[model samples]
Target: MSLAPRAVLVHRTTEYEELLARHGTAGQAAFFLTSRGRDLEPVAARHARARRTLAAVEAAVPLHWRRARVERADLDRFLFGPEDVVVVVGADGLVANTAKYLTGQPVVGVDPEPGRGLGVLVRHRPADTARLLTAAVRPDAAFDELTMVEAVADDTQRIRALNEIYLGAPGHQTARYRLATATRPDPAAPEESQASSGVLVGTGTGATGWLRSLWRERSGPPALPAPTDPRLLWFVREAWPSPTTNTTLVQGALTNGDHLRLVVESDRLVAFGDGVETDALELTWGQTIRVGLADLRLRLLV
Candidate 1:
């Protein structure tokens, strides 16, 4: 028989908690904030609200259902089961941060501070958890299959993100690579060698974030995709033109089966997702990587 579905509560360390940890005392934390021309009351209040909201969500879980709690820092090491019902109790970015580690688990995004957030992903309040949890396990439960992006290295190392995947140097230096795409209609077009900051591939959901800033600067066709659109958008950040390297293939759109291929020309290149640089795939010279739409979609409960 199948085991009962687990309610996995995901959260991040609050700023107040971090301050207290750093200062070793609440009074010292407040003093440090005061010295910086900021008040501690607001931070403490937000922390209190977060704790209350987390408690409420935990209390709402069905007593008999298996439950687990994980912090954002520990997500990389945490094991998520197939039958897990993930509940992210923080900002919308927290949901994005947690998305990559999960497979097809249904996620319920709960806004701890409702009015302050954009409410795009974290649409529900703490009180809605119990009802949402019940609906999430049903056969006809409604969910939005948010598209995600992935980068796969030739050695089988890979990473996925709900927002975007960044492949480039780990620092402020330029990254050198040969770029090509398999989806281009023009078969005669040749691949280009590039030396620049890096390459970024993002989904429609990501268009509102990093991709939006880049999209706004350029005026052209192939509009950004919708949140659920299967298409992806890619851009080469500050591609440097040289005698040998060209910037002809800077930006484009990708379809379902399309992928962007890159052969590393530098000593090292890193591929990371959702701005988490710590957990990334490292590539050496001559190693190839492909960026494309991932098979894993984020099953976000609406």
Candidate 2:
């Protein structure tokens, strides 16, 4: 007998669960929400709906196929094999976070909510679980390959990101770094040492996320990449001009063969991808880091 294909269901704690955890008691949670003029009914309803969705997914799964459930908090420690089919039952961010850890697994993004913004990634509803699962593990499953970004440090450490990678101080304080790029328009220009809030390197799939906010905040926003575009966009936040620091290399696009390098001029800097700080790369002064498009692509089941 052959082993059945495994399906991994990824989810996060519901709002009600979070409230109770924070308050330590149902009464306290209710009191806290009431104080904010919110009712617990909405949270309860959402939790109930999520449970129903999970149950439906469990029922839809074939007996021959192995099924596993993972919480968002444990995603970093979870081990995923290449043969597994990933199903995320959460918001859009959860899908992005899950994508980073996967190399070639087909991901089915399930939106717990029915008619909201129609999540860009989590487009499927809970009701479609059975049908999507059946198609996901098929040899000819229709999927879209989304681009991902990567950050490589001088210490030979590397992190891949499906959404965007953030490089800077742990807090909101200014980050001082020497920014250099292989694709700089002015080849003669020396590497620039600059002080800024931070830098964001993201792929086309991430354009609608953190990159979009940065684009919108600009005086003249540039066109961003589509979900499957094989390009990357990077920008420095609040680059400060000083006698020693320059801000000329604040924003640019990176193609397949291009790379962006940065030397940690500050005391400390950190690089995190998909907003998962637990899985972060730490950089001290005198360290150089490179950010670019990763060769691996996220195969998202559309």
Candidate 3:
């Protein structure tokens, strides 16, 4: 488990070949899969090729089959269960499936086409498939009993190693939310105030994203706000703001301390991490939505 991942991009021959070259048939491995929304032909073909290649790899691990692997139980296997990595190739749907199935999780969303997948792509990161699932068995997400301040074991590495975290509309509303934060950080009393139209959580890992969005309203390269580590939170809002189910967590003394509420007296509001909607929770005014920094820190292959 102390090595690179068993790379699983989308369903592709080239992707498999590429990842295979990086980490050969090793300890434990798998092909965690999701529908490409395309004919299974391509995926089947890639599976054949991957299977054949995997057959030849001496260090390869047994490949297990988890039918309809995107649901909660199956996804639990995807996230915390021990095995090695299950590579996800090209398309983002499968990548998204993985994220949707987990919580307080950091998923590196990779978009092959920037124009088509700007929002989701920015969230994906290359991961160590082998390491993530090793004895994961739904490990304790809280880091209260850690031997060190930094995580020596699994500690929200999903988000921390990836460094950046994303917030987006929970549904297809295209709705945006207001942002607010304390001028000074007060964890004990985070919900004391609210301000601004756009809410962004900028971390030390995602500087450019929070800052650049401020410049062009909504324009930037695919790789801005990339975080080296998780620290700091940026709050942003859109100009000529349209309604969105999104809410930004204020960094300072206010919102972080307690229940952050999104008022939905008239219209409904959706909330989610990054852009996936399964966990995209609907909200009502005076209703409490949870938000906070998780203790688990990711250890990247880098």
Best-fitting candidate, scored by lDDT = 1
Q: What's model 3's lDDT at 58?
A: 16
- The TM-score measured for candidate 1 stands at 0.97
- Give the 10-residue window scoring lowest on summed lDDT in candidate 2: 181-190
What count of clashes does model 3 give? 55
Q: In model 3, which regions exceed 4 Å deviation?
A: 1-59, 62-79, 82-198, 202-226, 239-267
Off by over 4 Å in 1: 182-189
- Sort by TM-score, top down from the best: 1, 2, 3
List, residue by residue over 1-302, the lDDT tens digit for candidate 2: 66678999999999899988899987898899899999988888889999888888778777788889999889878999877899998888888888777878889998888676558888898778889989988789999998999999989999999889999998858999989864744556457898999999988888877898897887654579887887888889999899998878778888877888889988989999988888899999999999988989888887
Winner on TM-score between 1 and 3 is 1
Q: What does candidate 1's lDDT look like per residue over 8-89, in tens digits?
A: 9999999999998899999999999999999999999999999999999999999879999999999999999999999999
State the lDDT at 288 in candidate 1. Answer: 94
Cα lDDT of all candidates, in order?
0.92, 0.86, 0.34
Root-mean-square deviation of every model: 1.4, 2.1, 12.3
Give one digit per residue, the lDDT tens place, for model 3 in 1-302.
34332323223344444444554632111232223233434534665654443333212222442311132225534443332333333343444334333333233333233354444323322232333333222344222110001111112122211222333343333333333233333445323223234244433333434344543444332233233332344433543412433333433311223222232322444444442345334553443333344454332111
2 or 3: which has the higher TM-score? 2
TM-score of each: 0.97, 0.94, 0.42
